[model samples]
Target: MNLLEAEKFPFQQTRFTRTSDIQTIIKLFSQFSKEELMKKNQEVSIAGRMTGKRMFFADLTDQSETIQLKFSSENKKFAELDNGDIIGVVRGIVCRTDTQEKKNERKLSVEVEEFSLLSKCLRPIPSSYYGLSDTEERFRNRPLDFIVNKQKKEIFFLRHQVIKNIRQFLEEKKFIEIETPILVSEASGAQAKPFITHHNKLHRDFYLRIATEIPLKKLLVGGFEKIYEIGRIFRNEGIDARHNPEFTTIEVYQAYENAEYMMNLTEELFHYLAEKVFEKEKFTFNSHNISLQKPFRRLSMIEAIKEHINIDFAKINGLEEACQLAQKFNLKLEKFQKTVGHVILAFFEKFVEKNLIQPTFIYDYPVEVSPLAKSKPENEEIADRFELYIGGLEFANGYSELNDPTEQKKRFEEQSKQKELGNEEIASFDKEFLEALEYGMPPAGGLGIGIDRLIMLLTGQNSIKEVIAFPQLKNKEKNFE
Candidate 1:
């Protein structure tokens, strides 16, 4: 039947006075003896969707638990009810049944006195006996997937708990949650191409934020000592098992702290999440076990490259020498990737990143790649930046934020030069951000963590899409035929 016809059907809309959930009822049944149950004979009511049916017996399930319902063959209303139908049973008595083949096994059931069909299932649901096997179909029809697989539903619940724990952890540390704009004239945050849109009323173009870094740091300059924003960031980038074009991030900034402080904070937060949320100090992701115990391994970017590739970047002096070494390794370089720092970063990405299976912090990044990070005091080429890698994925990026206006302007100029050299990922100089820095900002540290990746790691999910409820997918063109 059509939807309108189904709506017109005389389905009961009365409220059910359910005494307990299926689990609670089962617990109570186990507590009371069979003779005591019969003596008390307390009437119960419950409502849920019909999940299974076999002749006169049916299984009804709320999202939490499932209970059995037995119907008399003579009841016409019971005959009309089918699997996948919304049902409400009233004045039911708890009972136990034993099969002749399995006399030792007793099953709990509810003998129904009256029942109502709240909604009709006109279409047949996919067989729960067989399961939803197609991955694409499962993603497309997520609600049906949830119905068929309880584990899938629980993953989302776990995701919610993880986020809640993160919020609580940050709040306990006295970090203020703040919001920043999603659209702006310049997307000067991270090194990624932005999704641009025209603002009709203003008659100008605005880019969706690729990162929350710039604005949050500006708030730091505005005298908010500890601030954080958990928001969605958009980037026009390639999609992979780990990367999404649009994803959620938690960016935090604290004044009077350096990269070391952020690192320690990150370690503490992860340990807290593992203990409080998962109730463990370690968890396995994609067959690789990871520990959240204190003191994650720390390695400088150059040191990691040296360990993995056996090429000491510290000894390499000039751009020509770096390019020759990269060429010898057969690493591909873009047009703008000619500098020594760029080559070092390329080597790290190609040789070092995937091998970092344990929780490790690779710090001291090239200054050219980290425009907003402060340079190391002794060495001008390396920035006080670090990236947290676990399960062969980069989960977090943080740095000692650069507050020097003169040096910041010079760095922006260098980024502009790179943009002119055909690097689309290089951010344009944000005048407003520079002006804010000119107003005398404090020494600070900033960190950005990809929420989706973290969730995937903690939940043991292999892909970012698995953690995200509605991830971006390619458009399916309809076939007229």
Candidate 2:
């Protein structure tokens, strides 16, 4: 930024040293009485941006904390100080003060005996109250947003702690972390459109991974009993409150475990995070008070439909009848959704999904929509898959993985047909993943949670953009000089 009034204040400090920060000073001397501090007379060096009103008393803030600074207005250097100036307080005495301006309240502070202007804040730091009302403005300029709205720091702090505890929880269970490739020949694993890029070296097109599931599953096939990946996933899709083109997900797999076992694991993970990171079972998200303390409610897809809409879907025998039911509910069916299974899912999403405000697992997803999941032994039409929903958004998906190569091939063919029928988001027929399954991978369960959405829920953020620091925005030319 260009310096405003440059000729007035020249030669800002190139480097300055400090012995203590505001937080350390407060921690060390806040307990002592006024007489005790006067007797001890601790001298320290500190530096931070000058925040708040500046007369004799000013608040100097660093990342750790903010502390008061008292200076003489008569001192020419202090007299010329501006709010937002980066300055160092040299040989400052830790002291206590009482003032009528503070309603006779005693406050711990520091007396600024000597000072130095470390840097002249070239651009005026945006006003804390009036200047940052636009949401887009705040997002486009995150650094200024952090300075103006200090409370925003807590969101990221929670984000860090949440991810840290996730590693801790999974490590305690002996789950190894493996980073998979970002660019791949096939963006298979979950059904989503991929961001395609050409590889000049290989002379073939590659897609950014839409999910970490395929490679992590390969690790499982190569005989890692338990493994997980916290990874960035790219999808060629629209951006909205819950959807980002690039997002994060944690996909975990365990050998010799089934969908039911994974369901239990998902619940335990959430409960552990609630008690461990947040230290509470209740959280407010999207205007709902969700509790992780209770056992999560579980229901089959058809059961969930019945519970919410009083419609028993199991009795709907054929596509014609299902189509009629969709018509009755005013739900439009796309060309690829011309099956009983697809129509059942359509009905569930339209009628039941939003009603799952608290933690609820709706299982027995249609095999048409869940190609990687094993089919229930008794019901080949239904996959042994479940999705955990909270605050009307799907937080986690888990299933008993399909290990039979032949069945997996059939499912891939089904998905290819769906893609031909105008469904852009369908799993690819990954040749390598199929080859891995042919080696007889043990029957296993896999679970995936969108880390961004989970953080949004835990932190009470309504939009995905709030949790992410640099969310993508529409193209606009910079007109700045």
Candidate 3:
């Protein structure tokens, strides 16, 4: 019978006492000379999977580095060992490979006095020398990918460091981290389609939050300032190298702050990560060598369009003129995009967005595109909004929030009209949010950053899958290839 099919495997051990891990052993004794190691002759107990050809010599690896294992001679028990067998404990004296030492090699080995099998790997695990090359297969079977690719494991470590540092930085500034409901009655924060599900007990449908902006702002009205949330967001959207249906985002709100203050804070937070967390000044992202050391460029959207192309948006005074310009450029406008503000956005996206290769702040958006943002006092046509772009990708968005209940109601009404006019991604008319606005919220700044995209930029990864451990992929036939 197969070993796993037996009532109990005769070779398996229940437990063992491990004195240290392979990483600790490598770090502590790698610098010692062969003679120095022999002088100490320290005894240790370690457990790991057997990884090489098992005969008189083999390798043992844990979560960290691998170590060599040596026996006096080939025996019946040693010959039965195969790669991927989990050893319970190899209790032995730590010493150098005194007889088979190689030039410039310092990895110590365990002179095994005794060991037992903890478990047997019934499935075959590929060699660590060559990891899984098929991208789809690697993503589908993440455990195997992690087993063979050391760098793949390192990416998650870097991701953890990024989140940990962010929390530490905000905590130092007295910013409180809060969590909002994932299943919301209505999704109104962002302009995206939401995933819907029925709540059996409530007998009503709920939406997986597309953005955490709404509930977090509600907390601001309930007498909390300088709050933020780092949580998962779901969207019923298309997938690409940059997008996943399920992802992470962080939304921050600060009462008594304006758009300019939030912009400065965004820049400082990035600089802190580069200097304090990673300690690196330069990064290569989207084939561009971008640096975090320099100050970011700031330009208005209309100005960017002007800089990229010779078209002067300031000259287009009316909707008729904007329509004529759109016809000249062959720009197609949707049913809801019939206004001058929409035309301005169409022109900016077509001519300006892809040219922003470095870190830039594009500010002063039109009111039609920014409903939650406050309109400028001097010019009601423009909203006090800004977005951060690096490598032609949007990383952060921030604006001075609209605190007027009456104006907010008007905006939602406009959104309702648009929803009827073929805009499927319009924010719902959230009456509760409007009521919260009536309760008198302070003038504040709200900012949101996509955590996965930010990780991709910082890690120099082009595809979103490299940063995310398990991303959504197309369903394979029957089983994953």
Error of 3 at 234 (Å): 0.2
Candidate 1 TM-score over all chains jointly: 0.92
List ranges where model 1 is wrong by over 4 Å: 1-19, 23-36, 40-42, 99-102, 478-481
Candidate of highest TM-score:
3
* C-alpha lDDT of all candidate models, in order: 0.86, 0.88, 0.87
Off by over 4 Å in 3: 1-16, 98-106, 478-481
Estimate, for each residue in 35-82, the C-alpha lDDT of model 3 and write its tens digit. Answer: 888899878899888777545887887887688888768444566667
- What TM-score do all the candidates reach, one by one? 0.92, 0.93, 0.94
Task: State in Å the error of residue 343, model 2.
Answer: 0.6
RMSD to true structure for each model, in Å: 3.0, 3.2, 2.7
What is candidate 2's lDDT per residue for 189-267, written digit by digit as tens? 9889999999888899999999999898888889898999999999998888999999999999999999999999999
Candidate 2, residue 365: Cα displacement in angstroms equals: 0.8
Tell me model 2's lDDT, rounded to 2 decimals.
Answer: 0.88
- Judged by whole-model lDDT over C-alpha atoms, candidate 1 comes out at 0.86
